[model samples]
Target: MDTLRYELVFSEGTDSGSSAGDVVTVERTSATGPGGHPVYTDPTGIIRAEISDQGEVRVLATGGHQDPAQGVRARPLPDAEERS
Candidate 1:
């Protein structure tokens, strides 16, 4: 959806150069759930990623919370992930 977004963090890689470290991100969205609302992540998610030369995104690690399910608290756009 247009309202949803992912906040990404890029770090320098050892070999991959610029394309590397293009996958670390946190997705945020508004929602109503047992977690009280504004669940940060889906029920399950990928923690790490491995991008290929063809630009294919590969999930390296996965995790989730059973009860709350939310990964973070909702905050202001400027304080949190910002879109250009």
Candidate 2:
């Protein structure tokens, strides 16, 4: 399978002192999500994403949110990691 590459958009509060709309590169972890989708995490570990094979991105907030499941939605930036 081709490596899944993507970036995460971090908003204020999710990342302390960082400005809103900050983008960060994400690396796939050993974890899996629903239907065994690939789970990715940023360097800060503040954000987690499960991206479907069909390109659907599900944001999982590790912290900084009242409801962890109600993480800020984000679109997968295909190949965004290459630019990092």
Candidate 3:
């Protein structure tokens, strides 16, 4: 088993002001394969988030590769005026 480190950066958004940075740590584990074989892997993943100037929150992460399958997409956090 091993530990993985990841860094996340948040740039200024259309509404949100800005953010410093985020650090993440992940632990690996082993599992059984389709054929009942042992497989040791640490699947890649992606973290998605939305931030608003008013501090509204709507965020989530997908446990998988950071590739196309991750569907890494995000839109500006809606402003109070747009929430109506």
Candidate 4:
């Protein structure tokens, strides 16, 4: 599995209200979604995202409550770490 790290920025608002404008770590998973897009997971394990080859992000719910994050932007991170 090829692992990569990213910084996810939420400028708008999220499902969970607390995470708006929060920056979170997102790691690439071995799994792939539609069109062979790579799947990523947050440190909280509540946010699952599918990033397309074109850099489009599709957030997936884990059937639980998560901190809200509005307009999201994904940035490549040199290192990956869990943060609250």
- Candidate 1 structure quality by residue, lDDT tens digits, 1-84: 232433333444345445444433444445333423332343345443332222233333344542321222222223334533
Best by TM-score: 4
Q: In angstroms, how far off is 35's CA in candidate 3? A: 43
Kindly indicate the candidate among 1 and 4 with the higher lDDT: 4
What ranges in model 3 sit over 4 Å off? 1-45, 61-84
TM-score of each: 0.23, 0.56, 0.20, 0.65
Where model 4 places Cα greater than 4 Å from the true spot, the runs are 1-3, 13-20, 64-70, 79-84
- For each candidate, the alpha-carbon lDDT, in order, equals 0.35, 0.66, 0.31, 0.70
Off by over 4 Å in 1: 1-3, 13-20, 24-26, 29-39, 42-44, 48-84
Query: Residue-wise lDDT of candidate 4 within 16-63, one digit each (tens)?
Result: 666567677888988886667888898777877777755567776667
**Shift of residue 1 alpha carbon in model 3, Å:** 43
Residue-wise C-alpha lDDT for candidate 2, range 1-84, written one tens digit per residue: 645556665465564655566676777888998768888888778767887766667776576644544334445555656668
Best of the two (3, 4) by TM-score: 4
- lDDT by residue for model 3 (3-75), tens: 1221233343334553533433222225333443332222353433332222232234345443311211222
Cα lDDT, model 1, residue 65 = 48
Which RMSD values do the candidates have, in order? 12.4, 6.3, 15.8, 6.7
